[model samples]
Target: MDNFIGEIRLAGFGFPPKGWALCNGQLLPVNQNQALFSLLGTAYGGNGITTFGLPNLQTRVPLGMGQQGGVNYPWGQAGGEAAHALTTAEMPAHTHALTGSAGGATALGPANNLLATPAAGALYGTGTDVSLASSSVGPSGSGQPHQNMPPYLVINYIIALVGIYPSRS
Candidate 1:
């Protein structure tokens, strides 16, 4: 089949076939690949005068151009991180409830360590000022970045280097 110049496709093979170059963001001479340079320009990255760049698909997936659901994604735009660390604002709004008894014989419950006793006889103790201990749960996590990418299969993205030049309708 005759592929259009600059066309990109996934391949199971380890190397690109004849007339196709791996989309590894390598710079190409504009004078050498004029047809491809005309279509791709330097959107990926290049001086644009002597060199042009191929779309880099290494360890990355392609996303359709334009907006969807009010989110705009212009052509040749790259976004998203391989991993992310959640912030306090990103966490859901919720609270931890501490429950237990104090001053009574059964005050030695799980939450008794967090309970405080002020003024001995005020609650159920002797006529002495006794203050209980204050406790809290330690913060969790070691502050590491978690994988943010979805499950995906590995493949090579190859672009056509020699093919029919595509024209706008």
Candidate 2:
């Protein structure tokens, strides 16, 4: 039966050794120890070598997700962690303040006199020119949201590798 062994041939400079041959049948010297090898039929397989067509490439193969903790694309954490969205209580206790009105006595008209002066801590901003600068200025109601918080998931991935095949065998 006819069989073939894939050969790695080299190109450029000098002739190949006696046993090897160029796919195109061109005689050349190939220094096995140092010569670059190409998957051409040129290299001599000698006695066991048979002549046959190249094999078809495999259709499918699996890839590593890098979660293996070994060298792989998208290298990072070996797996993923479970987590959920923060509830209203979970959110950092904080407040958002509104922009204060520009300060200036001239801005206040005759009406500025009718207002009474507020005691310390009772209110901020001057008469007539009273603005949102007051400590009371902020979102009202149970600014605390509903307790039913939605779920949150995180998957960290970055790099990807493709188009890799084994060398001739």
Which candidate wins on TM-score? 1
Candidate 1, clashing residue pairs? 117-132
Off by over 4 Å in 1: 97-139
State the local distance difference test value for candidate 1: 0.86
lDDT of 2 by residue, 1-169 (tens): 2113233333343443443333332232233421222333332222213332221111211244454557555511122223344446756888775443333333234463433334233345466854676556644454443444246332221111111223545
Off by over 4 Å in 2: 1-83, 102-169
lDDT leader: 1
Count of residue pairs whose backbone atoms collide, per candidate: 1, 7
Q: What is the lDDT of residue 43 in candidate 2?
A: 28
What's every prediction's RMSD, in angstroms?
4.9, 19.8
